[model samples]
Target: MSRKPIIGKCRLCGEIKKLTFEHVPPETTFNNYSVRILSGEEVIKQVADPNNPPWDFSDTKGTIQQRGRGGYYLCGDCNSKTGQWYVPEYSKFVHIVHSALQEVKGKEFGALGIKMKGIKPLSIFKQIMTLFCDINEGMMGDNSLKDYLLNKTSTNFKRERYHLYMHIHSGSVERMNGIMVQFASGVGLITLSEISTYPVGFALYIDKPEAYNPEGVEITIFSQFNYDDEIELEIIIPKLESNIFFSGDYRTKEEIENAIQESKDN
Candidate 1:
């Protein structure tokens, strides 16, 4: 018989805490079954093509794929608190989308003229996104995140921007699709290149710098593997000089490396 994963000290408080399942992308975004099975299958197909199997498959079949562990162990209190904290903020995010769709015009394209305009949802979303990014980066031991708003901060903003870009460009209602796919499939790692191709309809610059120089803004991605564990990926995005913008998805590892190489070349 197989032994169950053990619950020991809480990652946050270090108490002898009870273990419960936690979803990195938030379970409210997708059906549990779809996240576990269908998304798992998709990842398998991507990584384990029979014609070009670079890695051994026998050991991977029964075990959960590396990418599929977006959801993992958590204590009840942490889980409940995360839900309560993000739900209202997520709802506000939806409202911002609604307002943007209703009021934003073509002439406003590529212009940073769009303001938050007392939209509490956008403000709250920004704050929560910042917090989530900080926690994830802290877990990864990246000591570069000093300014949350001015510098390249967190992966959550990148993911959120990717979703918003998709909704605007593809006319698709699957705003949370990429995040759901990552969470369900255990593929928390993504690069800038992958997201750049995600059919974004608007221009987005997350924590992009205000001026252009040799040391352009650096964009980084991070994710929670288990409740306490996390990972990071970095990419450098140039400062945008024009206003015409379109949004898309986040990048995968390969894509991120490709972007970094391209930046070096430039």
Candidate 2:
């Protein structure tokens, strides 16, 4: 006999219902098919076998290069609502970003830069915000995010209060989809920050005017953006801390080079 469908509260509406697969970054962004996987244990053994000896894990560990996986996380109603209202604009935006990677005439940083046009900022913002919600609710198992979203509501969601940060990155076969939820207490208030990575990287968090910014990190500007304005995103090499790493992003310089070579072969 087939197992009974699990009853759960909707991430978008908070209504109890049967759950559905909710692709976190939306399915269209998963166009890249190049595959590459690696094992940390294998690398550790390889590095340790020569210098330290007896740290071998190659027998137990290996790399992973497989087709991307989708998240099965949502209720039927929310899945339908988001598909109707948000996915179209999000699909367009992802296409533009990926197209910039695939084709470019002559421009500085052509290989790793993008120039986007005819963007609907509100739509894209909502789409990205939705991704944050999906990760927080579906993956991280938090249900409180409906304050900013949910059907049949004109929420007093303050766009400016929440900040969006995008990190431009190149795709590799090893790239994955993931999120990191962090709580930081500073500036007199505890802030909940959610960072997500897949086709791109983004940080969704609260920021107040003239607040004590202890993080010292400069997030990108995305709220209240003009829908018709042209926007350009460029990639730059920077030193990063391991704690803040976006699991879905390119991990290392070697991984970056391998991804470039794989792209050329394809």
Candidate 3:
């Protein structure tokens, strides 16, 4: 059966055009495999029932996406522009991180400062923002991203209003969260969106508070680099786990199981 046409507003350009499947991390960067897409209720049930077979679709509310983990969120024009201008460099960045991780697997370390060269930071950052826009539903207030994304060489993202962070992520779960707000005890009110998959995770905090210090290496500096500029830097990315549904919850599976056991014992 043919998939029905999905017509809606373009997340980036805000144009009402025929939308196309926009890959959040690009299919070339390890997002090509089939995965189960679950709702919040489904996720809670799956977590509670550890023996539930994730591969079994008969008794579940989740849908298995065979093409890849993405949706028809962007119009063809915006998708083409972002793919041509930004995705190449961003894909290279992801592969580089994955290579580094493979080279140092099973080592005891909190973080790794991977030295990367010839990286187009602006393009990578723009690609990251495009993913953020795709996962979100509505256009940003004031349409700031419109100007920043539509222009291929534009680097005028609203730095004061948005901050981006990144970490090395590994776990069974792949998260593509829309914009959500939550209050952390010491972190104040955090209004953020995140995309956590293998190799890397990103969080964009909107109108972040001054006192809010979030986990992960701040990569807002990527916005400052020129689109074509290539530079070398060592990024210290701490490995984090996405075993839970929460945006910033990086607890490992062992930690989670121990906590659950303790709760049952108590």
Candidate 4:
């Protein structure tokens, strides 16, 4: 049965309208499969149990989303416009990276200089920002994002308030976290959100401190490109493994296992 139309505040544009499912990452970018969406607390409970093995989510508690990982956070007009304007180009860029990852499947962890050809960097970046908007509602609600996304040619996003980072992701879990504040060892307190799925992951830092040093390559420069300016460029993106449920956790499988064993030993 088709679900009834949901009425709510649109994440983008902040208008009260009929909401539609806005995929965090576009559906074509490997987000169409069935996934069990778990809350951060649920994941922490599992991960906190020292007896529970890593990557074993068979008995985990979560709502099984048959369609994909997304929610009705956008209205029809905003959804249609962003989907038409940004998804295609973003999907192409994701596929290019996916193909590159496949070629170097068993290789060691290192940076890859991918020579992406004929890509609309602005559209790709806007699509990523769209994902950020979808994930966050009241916390990161800035009208600048709506204006930046709605106007295809506008390059006036508030760069001082936001920074976008990307990394190649290979993990067993997909994540979509709302705005969270956490303290890093050297970085003190930082505010950020993360969306990590297959082949790619993105972290959006909100009001980042000068001392905050984040993993992955920053791509906030993509906002400067014009709408139709297709260009060839190479980006050196590092591969990071997200084997656990923690946001921005990039411990490898071997590293995770070793840590688990050490915990038991101690």
lDDT of each: 0.33, 0.50, 0.84, 0.86
Question: What RMSD does each model have against the real structure?
Answer: 13.4, 9.0, 2.8, 2.0
| Candidate 4 wrong stretches, greater than 4 Å | 257-266
Among these predictions, the greatest TM-score belongs to 4
Give all TM-scores, in the order shown. 0.36, 0.57, 0.90, 0.92
Model 2 stretches with alpha carbons more than 4 Å out: 1-4, 31-68, 104-114, 138-148, 151-155, 171-198, 207-266
Stretches off by above 4 angstroms in model 3 are 1-4, 47-61, 261-266
Error of 3 at 225 (Å): 1.2
Error of 3 at 223 (Å): 0.2
Total residue pair clashes for candidate 2: 5
lDDT tens readout by residue for model 3, 1-266: 99788898998888888899977779988999987788878766766775643322346668889988999999999999889999999999999999998889988777878999999999999999889888887654648788888897888878999999999987766788988889988767888999998889998899999998888999999999888899998888988777777787788877877777787799
Pairs with backbone N, CA or C atoms under 3 Å apart (clashes), candidate 2? 22-73, 36-65, 37-63, 37-64, 38-64
TM-score for candidate 2, residues paired by index:
0.57
* Over 4 Å off, model 1: 1-11, 14-16, 30-33, 37-70, 95-138, 142-266
Candidate 2 lDDT, 1-266, residue by residue in tens: 99678788765676788987665567677733432333444444554443322222335345443443334456887788767766787788767756754554344351244446665555566677676666555523444446444532333446555655555443322223334343435545433444333445454555543454423123335434543444654433222211112342324545544655686699
lDDT of 1 by residue, 1-266 (tens): 86586575433333467665554334332223332222445445644453432222333334343442234334566556545644454444434544554565444343222233333333233333433332232312223322332222232333433211212222211121222111112333231111211122222233222231112222222221122222231222221221111113323335544655686699
Candidate 4 residue lDDT tens string, 113-173:
7999999999999999998888888528677777888898898888898889999876676
Give the candidates in order of lDDT, highest first. Answer: 4, 3, 2, 1
